[model samples]
Target chain A: MLPFVFEWQWDIGHGVFMGLFYLALTIVSLGVVAALAMTFYDLYSGKEVHEEGHGHEDPWADYSYAHDKADRGEYA
Target chain B: MDDSKFWPKGTTRCKPVHFGLWMLFCLALAGWALVSAFLCLYKGLNQTNMNDYFAFGVWIVVDLAIIALGAGAFFTGFMNYVLRREELKNIINAAVIIGFICYSGAIMMLGIDIGQPIRGWFGFWHANVHSMLTEVMFCITTYLIVLIVEFVPLILENRQINKVPDLHFFAHNLHTIMIVFAATGTFLSFFHQGSLGGMYGVLYARPFAARGGVLIWPWTFFLFILSAIAAGPSFTTSIVMITEIVTGKKLTTHKVKMLMAKVSGSLLLFYLVLKIADTLYWAFVQTPAMGLSPSVYYQAPYGTWLLIAELGIGGVLPCILLLSPQVRESYWILLLAMLLNCFGVTMNRFVMTIQSLAVPVLPFEKFYAYLPTWQEWGISAGVIAYGFIIFSLAYRYLPVFPQETKLNPTTD
Candidate 1:
């Protein structure tokens, strides 16, 4: 549905419909990527996590956020 | 309670033997459909009785019917995320699961309906940007992706599936951004539902289904969106109630069911008023303007009875019942009303698909009738069976109703 695609049209109908279409596709794809990255990072960082839904107790579970690579100076 | 090992925390399920028997029945249906599907594919559409007159047969009817029924997914999500109706959070997972089943099942059947599964992707590769059908194909395929995104977190949340930390974190992250997907779903759903109606409406030459509209969209377009939104929540509530009956457990609170019914009833009332107006205008104004009478539409095998059933029994009657506190207060009555409401919307689809084609625009042309071949029935029943199998599996493994544990502390 991209503009560069051969079938793309310059009219308002195609522009508006396809615009919203691609916008949604982009958002969902980005969300999936972010979730996958955070999951892998959390696993590698060895974050303390108690097993949930087993009716067990764990008050001292560790929670960590996936930090941005740029903020960690990866680009520098 | 031995299956408690697989059940969600603080909840109970039916005996596994009973569950297996239930699945075996559903699988038998699916197995029949699978054979029928292969016959359709290999032997071609000759396996069905469809012809030039009924190009869009039972399969399209099922497609429109289920997609409309499945609107509960987006509508419920819209309420929870966009409208922030926190109470809706309880039933949202079940809505998503049902939506997934309806849509994926529709797509699976549609693949065989086209009679060359290989060419199904042709719509995407060499798409027509201007065609309403192209819009429908793109939006439905995209929304199915969005539904998958919405449904995966639920699948991942299964007691066993979530044991993997990465999957757990992934599911949690997906939940955090669900608003994005929900809003996107609402956007895509609105168009595809409307476009499905638009497909019929654009047959301007066919006065039966065609109507005046705003801009490119016909009145049927808006009516479809309205009818779907009105019927969707009711369908979801009905499914939840049926599950409760079959399992002998209260999966959701009556309060939640009533809340959904109240919303459904209000929307249905709103839809009925407009639908009545649309029919009147189409019959009196539009049809007469085309030099045809409304009587031109009512033929043998399709009579004014269809319209009366769609509007009066299916629409107005259920609308009144669902709106009443007394009716909705009774669990059985509410379920019946929901069933009627669904019936009305499905009748609307059937009329649009079959009766529209049944009508003769030219006086020289004769009235027509269509009875789907066994192959068509086989495929259709298979779709229903697929929905049952998927939803059953989800209910057994996933925590579909968040309030299930709280509502039913113990089951005999």
Candidate 2:
């Protein structure tokens, strides 16, 4: 067991372990929340989202293509 | 009879009949697993070879091994999103899918291994904050959720699925903020991997498994983390290579594989150095301090050969081959090295879980050799079958390999 830390005290072990664990959970939950918020906003605002391989280009297409090119060693 | 519409754009798939046959094979294995699970649940723990002495058998070993192998998802995500290693984007999707398969499969195996499916939540409900297992349970389940969240974007990106405007915007938004999940995953994965090793390390009664350490964490804790990150990318790359061979298509560019190899080799090299030191210390100092010779821990069946194979052949040899620029360029050689690297980590897990328990602590107690029953083997095979089915489905329908179109250009 955590012999170095008292059970009641918020010692370094509990502080660091539980703190980081909760911090990670918060970040993940917040990310999902933000995505949901954005999705609803875009849907209600009547923004047109480009479907994959559709005539309209994907917003992330340029960045992804550049990454693909780089991975293929096409660019120095 | 065209399912091609559902396939990723510019990709070719086998005929439905051929894919169906493959699915049938995987389903057979799944059927076997179901029977085994039913027997184990109905007949109780007596259906398996596990006993009071060997509470952990093949299931635990496979669980540990796959979880370690699955480290690629988080590590790759961390690199691509957090470190801005954009080239990794080509392979990151595959890594995520593999991670999902591994984590979810592991949790399922644990559900059976725990012997009581109903009260399984007790571990979470009545939390033991002091135990390393609590940390592992919390992090693994939480990280699995993160992986699912990460995987959702890809699932939403499927050709047919992407057409829904709301889902499209949701996937896009998720992609934009993926760094947050990636960072969170990295944090969870790091701790769980370490806590698993720490669980073994903290077995103070089992001198074979116990180790001296800094603060609450043992050397095995850090070693587990290092080995997972090291072997993880290699396992992911190996799966990608196998998929390419099976499908007869180029999925990702060779450079992406090379980057993975480089990352794996560097981390592996770091891991090996410490692992060797840990072994040496355990053999010479730690074992003697416990009033037991290291040789006592390595009796017949768990002989010195296990150490030689784990460290020498599986560890050092793979490290050398992977780090060699000339050797890595050759496809088969690189694949062999990565497979060997994975074998090394799996062997390490086997040794930690099985061998540690096999050794007799008390003078009257005898060394117990454990062979898992058919039910155990079936369950293990089912995990592999599950992985194959999941990966196959993901690769077929999802836009898993971003570079797939460019790598194997179709001539119409």
> Per-prediction TM-score of chain B?
0.98, 0.99
Runs in model 1 deviating more than 4 A are A1-13, A44-46, A50-76, B1-3
Please write out the lDDT profile of model 2 over residues B74-113, one tens digit for every residue: 9999998999987788888889999999999999999999
Question: Candidate 1 on B50-136: residue-level lDDT in tens?
Answer: 887788899989989999999999999999889988777778888998888888888988898888999898887666777888888
Give the per-residue Cα lDDT of candidate 2 at B410.
74
Tens-digit lDDT track of model 2 for A1-76:
2345344345675666566667777888889999999999999999996755321122222323343465445796
Report lDDT per candidate.
Answer: 0.84, 0.88
DockQ for each model: 0.13, 0.26
lDDT of 1: 0.84
Q: Give the TM-score (0 to 1) of chain B in model 2.
A: 0.99
